[model samples]
Target: MQFESVSESRLSFVVCFIAAFVGCAPLLQAQTEPAAPHTFFRVKAAETLTAPVSGRLLLFLKPGSGDKEVSIDEFHPTATYVAAQEIHDLEPGEEVEVNADQLAFPKAFSELNGGLYEVQAVLDTDHNYNYAGRAPEDWISNVMALAGWKPGSTAEPELVLDHHPEEDAQRKAAYEKLKGTATADVARLEEFESPALTRFWGRPTKVRAWVILPPDYVKSGGKYPTVYWTHGFGGEIDSALVSGLRIYERMKAGKMPPMIWVMLDESCPQGTHEFADSVNDGPWGTALTAEFIPWLEKKYRMDARRDGRFVQGHSSGGWASLQLEVNYPKVFGGTWSTSPDPSDFHDFTGIDLYADHANVYHRPDGSAYPIMRDKGQVLATAEQFTRLEQVLGPYGGQMTSFDWVFSPKSVSGAPEAMFDRVTGDVDPKVVAYWQEHWDLAHVVSTHWADRGADLKGRIHVYVGTADTFYLDGAAHKFDAVLKGLGADAHFTYIPDRTHFDLYGVGDDRQGLFDEIGQQMWDVARPGKSWKNRQ
Candidate 1:
C-alpha cells in the first residue's frame, strides 16, 4: 500500500510479481505433469472353443515388473470387447505376480461349441518374460508355437490380444487346404480317438489311449501280450505314428509277431508328469499303475498279467518308465527306457540346475536367488542367456513334473528340495531336503535292483552320444549301476545323433524305427525272427 504510488522501477517490480502469481510468466507452472496415465494391456478374446465352458473370460494383470491391476469391464459386452488392460507404474526393475481368471456366464451356447479359441495378451512393456526383439527363439514363443498359438496381425499388439478375425479365418482356410491336398503328404500322421477331458490328479487332462487288436483277434479269442507305450516329454500318444511302433505296423504286415500296443497318455495338465509318486503334486506313479493300466486292461481284450505287459518312454518319460518298471516289476514284466534321468547328484544335468534359479528352492526369506545365472562360477553371454532361457522354458513350464516326482513336500508342507547342480553353494537346508527324497545316487543303487528283480532279463536302456541335452551321462551312469546290481540291463548308444533327431522323422528314420520295434518284439515274444539285434 505504501509503495502504490511508487516510481517506474517500483511499478515494474509489482507488475512482474503479479504476472508470476497469475502464471503469465515462465516461473509459474502446474505442480506436476499428469503422469502418463497407466495404460492397461489389451488382449483379444476369441469365442471359438467355448461350449459348456462359461462366458469368454479374459485373464488380466500379470506379475513381475509389468502392470499389476486389470479391469474386465472394458471387455466387449457384445463381440469385439477389449478383454483386459493392465495398470502399470513406471519404475526400475521390479517383480510382480501375473494372473488371469475365467469369466463365468450362467448358460452355455450350443452353436459355438467344440472349436479352438485363440486369445492374445499384448505385451505393452518392452520387458517381455522373454524379450522377443533380443531373443526371438525364447521359451514363451516356443511353447505357444507347440500349443498352436499364433500372433495377431495388428501392429505390435498389447501383451495379450485375441487372435484377430483374419487369423482365425486363415487357420480354417489352412485346415481345409491340408485336409483336401494330395501333394507329398509328409505332415499327415495317424489320428486316434482321444477320450473325454477328465480330471486326473485334480487337473483337466485328456487321455488318448488306444489298443491295437492282436493279429489273430478274430481267430483266437485268447488274450495277447501287450506293450504299454509311454511317451517322452512333449511326445503325445499320437507321436507313436512316427516312432518305432509305426514301423511295427509295417513289420506286422510281413513277419513281426502279433502283439497288442496300448499307447497311454503320460502327460498331465502341466505336460509330462515324470510318472512318479509325489507329495504335493498329483500321484502320477500310482495313477499310471492303478488308473491307466487297469483302465486299459478292462477296456481291451489283452492278458492283464505282468508277464504279458511291458513299458517304454524316452528321456524324462524314459526315466519314468524305468523307475516304474523297477518300482512295479510285478506290474510290468519289462521296460525299455532311453536317455533316462538316472544319475541324481552326480549327473549335473538334472532339473534343479536348469530351472530359473529365482523359482527354484526358496530361502527362509522367500527368495531363491541364484548367485549367477550360469553355473555358480561361469558367466553367460546375452546369446547364451537367450539359449538358456529357451532350454529352461520347456522345463520350467513343466516344473510341476519334476517338483512332484523328485522333490516331495517337507514337514512344513513346502517343496524343500535342491539338485546337485545348484547344491554346491546353495542353501544347505534346501540341499538336505532334496537329498532326503530323491538322491538318485542312493535310490538307483540301493533300491532300483531290488525292486526290479522280476525284470532282470527284460530291462533295455539306450542313449545317443550327441544327445543335445547332455543327458547321456546320467543314462550311462544308470547303466553301470544296473549292471552292478546283476540286473540284466542292455544299452545302445546311437552315434552322430542328438536327442531331438532320434524322436522325430530322422534321416535314418526307418532304421531307428526298425530297431525299436525289434526290441519290443523281443520282450513280447521272447523269441522273434526280427532284425536290429546285431
Candidate 2:
C-alpha cells in the first residue's frame, strides 16, 4: 500500500501534447516540385480590442457536413481534434497559428480525417477555460467552413476572433429552475468571505455554496446535523444548487430523513483543489474548519460539533471529504466518499510513481496505458487524457489540478507538475513531496499511533470494481493499508459498478445514501431510530 502521490494569465508552453504515436504526424515527402504545405488552422484576435490579450489559444474542429451544430465538450465519446498555441499580446489583426507541429489531442491537423470541417478558435482570455469554459470576455471566432481539408493539404483555413461566445444563459436558466424547484425559504445560495482565502489570492475571494434547509427546519425549532457536500472537476456553484434541489426533493418526499445539506463549491480556476491546503492552492482546509463551519453554526440552527457534521461527496469532492475527516478528525463526524481520485499513488490511474523510471503513458513492454474503461472495454488512454489537458490549458485540468493540490510550489510560484506532460516521466521530487503531505494511505499509516483513535471508524469509502479511471486499484491498496494498520475504516468496492453508478447497487437507486443518512442520524441523535419514512 505504499503511495507516493496557477498564476495570472501567464504563458505555459505545453510541448508535443500528442503522445505514444506523436511521431506518426505526417512528414511532407519530396516527390513533387513544391512540397505540399502542412495543413494548419490560423487564428487571430480582433482589431477592435482596446488592449493586448494573452492566454492559451484553443481550436475546435468538428464535422460540418450535417445541419446540427457541432457541440464541443469535454469527455466526448468521439474525441474532437483540438490544437493549442499559447499567444501573448496577440496584437490586433495579427495571427497565431496552431499548425500540425503544435500541441494537439487525439490527432493533429496532419493526422485528422480528410473532410469538410467546422473550425472555431477561442482565446481563453483569463486562462480559465477549464473552469469557466468560454467566459464573457473570452474572444471566440465564428465557425469557419473548411472545404476539402485533408492531411498535408496546401489549403490553410483561418478563423477571426471578432466576437465573444454567447453568454451562459442556459446555466443561468438552470440555476433559476433549481431555485424554483423548492420554496424560497427552503433553499439559499450564499457566499462567504473567507479571511484565509482572501489573503491567499490577494483578492476578496468568496466561498459560494447552496444551503438547503430541512422541510421542518423552521417549524421544528430543533438543531439538525449537516451533511457537507461538494462536486468533482468541472463543477461550480450552479452545480451545488442542482445537488441541493435533489436533496430537498428527497427530504420533502420523505424518501430520506431530513437533514441540512451544505453543498460547497470547491471548483476554482486552478481546478478542484479537493480542499487540500497547499502552498499554491491556499489554506482551504483551514478555511473550512476554522472559519466557514463556525460561521455556519451561528447563522443557522446547525449542530456544528464533530458528531453532527458529516462530510460526503463524489470523485474529487470524495477526496476532499476523506481528507477533511482525516486532517480534522475532531471537526467532522465521518465521511462517505464515492469513487474518489487516486487515494493511493501506487496505481495512479494505473502507473506507479515509486517504480524506477516510472512512466505514466507507457509500460516496459512498450504498450500504451489505459486510463478509462467500461464493461471491461478500454475507453481512453492515460496519454489521451494528459494530452487533452495540455491542449485545454495548464491550470484547471484534472492532472494539473492534482499538481495544484499535491505538489510543492516551484520557483515560479506555481504548483509543480508531478510528471512531464510531454514526456510522461514522473518527477521524483514532486512524488516525494506528495507522499509526505497528501498521500492518504501513507498519512494514515504514519500517524496511526498519534491520530488513529480520532480517525478510527470515522472513514467510510465506496468505490467501484470497474472504475472508469482505474481508481479501484488505488482504493484496494488503501483499503488494504487501513486493514493492516488495524484502523476501523470501512471501504467497499461494489462489483460491476463504474465511477458514475456506484450508488445504484441495490434495489433502491440511492440505497447506500439512505444507509449513510441513517448512520449519521444515529450519531447525531443517539437511540432515536431515525429511519427513512419510506
Candidate 1 structure lDDT: 0.46
lDDT of 1 by residue, 1-534 (tens): 000000122234456678877867443443234422222223322233222111122322211222222222111212211222233441222222222211211111111222233333333322222211112211110001112212222222233222221235685676556434312211222222222223433445444554455445556565767776666655555454344345344444654455666665665434466666666556666666776667767756667888778787777767777777766888988887776654454453432432334223233343332211211222222122222222222223333345545665668864544432222223445544555555554565666546646767777777777665556666676667768877777878877556556544355444454455566666656775533321
Instruction: Quote each prediction's TM-score.
Output: 0.56, 0.87
Per-residue accuracy of model 2 over 36-86 as CA lDDT, tens digit each: 455677777788977778888887777775422233444452456777788
lDDT score of model 2? 0.78
Worst 10 residues of 2 by lDDT: 1-10
lDDT of each: 0.46, 0.78
The residue pairs found clashing in candidate 2 are none
Q: CA lDDT of 47 in candidate 2?
A: 87
Query: What lDDT is reached at residue 256 by model 2?
Result: 67
